[model samples]
Target: MKSGCQWRMMPKDFPPWQTVYDHFSRWNKAGVWECALDKLNERYRHSKKRAVPSYAIIDSQSVKTVYASEERGIDGGKKIKGRKRHIIVDTVGNLLHVSVHRANINDTKTGVAVFERAAEKYPSIKAFSGDAGYRGTAVTFVEERLKLKLNISTKIKDVFAVLPIRWLVERTFAWLNGFRRLAKYVEILTATAENMIRIAMVRLTLAKLP
Candidate 1:
């Protein structure tokens, strides 16, 4: 598909299709894709019409990887070879931050990175919502470092209090899955995998424009 696009568009001066594909392949390996996503998110924040986010949602999803090595480790939860995508989404389901880690990495560990990064990037973010997996140190880190509040959604009598807002983050995950690349894991390197995710998000932001 990429080769065909290059052939039709450039026709005469185009570099070899394999070379172009190789560049993208290499960029993914080096984590350029994820960096691109970060830049896009930065741009989005600067140009956004809404006021700063008062809250965000946090969660992790498991994606299956075909090339599993001793380095990546095993995921007992999914029972498949893969990695975890830890993401933070805003009240409107817009992605604010993300981290990719080995499937075996605990959700709480990745949660720290996600919140810290988000706090650094968007200082106005004041609160976060998530499940019990984010209960202990995860809650403390956000409070101590980010100086933000934590709102955990549990099966309590006050479920109604949390349901409306918490769903935004879940909806964001569903929106991200709309991109087929995210639906299946294909990248060889973690950086490249993150780049695809960033691209999907940038595309989403652009789509929302008038």
Candidate 2:
């Protein structure tokens, strides 16, 4: 699946395509991928002499999905007809949480949903930073309800200037793009797509550690 090939087109050297796919589905349901990524994150953070992050950065990417995709919508601003991937990453750009949703969804709405989910998984997270897309009343809702600061980076007037904190999540998205499967939203099931992101981050995190 990481190869992003059709199940039937799996290499002959590999196990039967059906068997491989079934195992993958089972692992996703069993939370194997999530657990592995969590361990790798913990180990990597420790290796870097940092505790699990209390602050994170959140952002979303609009990705074009295949024709067969069911959970997709058009992102009018980007003019992309597909799904959006909302992700939160720690200070050093490690995955903290990921949410897949329709492209048409409002960034603030999606941010709320993803942040609520992240709050559950990462209770230590007390603050997060985002771009202008996530600004407005939603920032207050997160702070008052989730008790986490939603720091919105000031919109940069200079195109070349790097915005603090917000840029880290953008870099994390770039790292995810390195995985072929993530170049586009190829997974038919949203859960599978989320797992793929987790798997890619797991590999990247583990590789960073001794």
TM-score of 2: 0.94
TM per candidate comes to 0.76, 0.94
Instruction: Compose the digit string of candidate 1's lDDT tens values, residues 88-197.
Output: 88865667777777788777767988888888888888898888888888899888877888888785575455466767777777887777667756666676667767
Error of 2 at 22 (Å): 0.7
lDDT of model 1, residue 184: 59
Q: Which parts of model 1 are misplaced by more than 4 Å?
A: 1-15, 22-48, 68-71, 156-162
lDDT of each: 0.73, 0.87
lDDT, candidate 2, at 191: 90
**lDDT value, candidate 1, whole model:** 0.73
CA RMSD of all predictions = 4.9, 1.4
Off by over 4 Å in 2: none
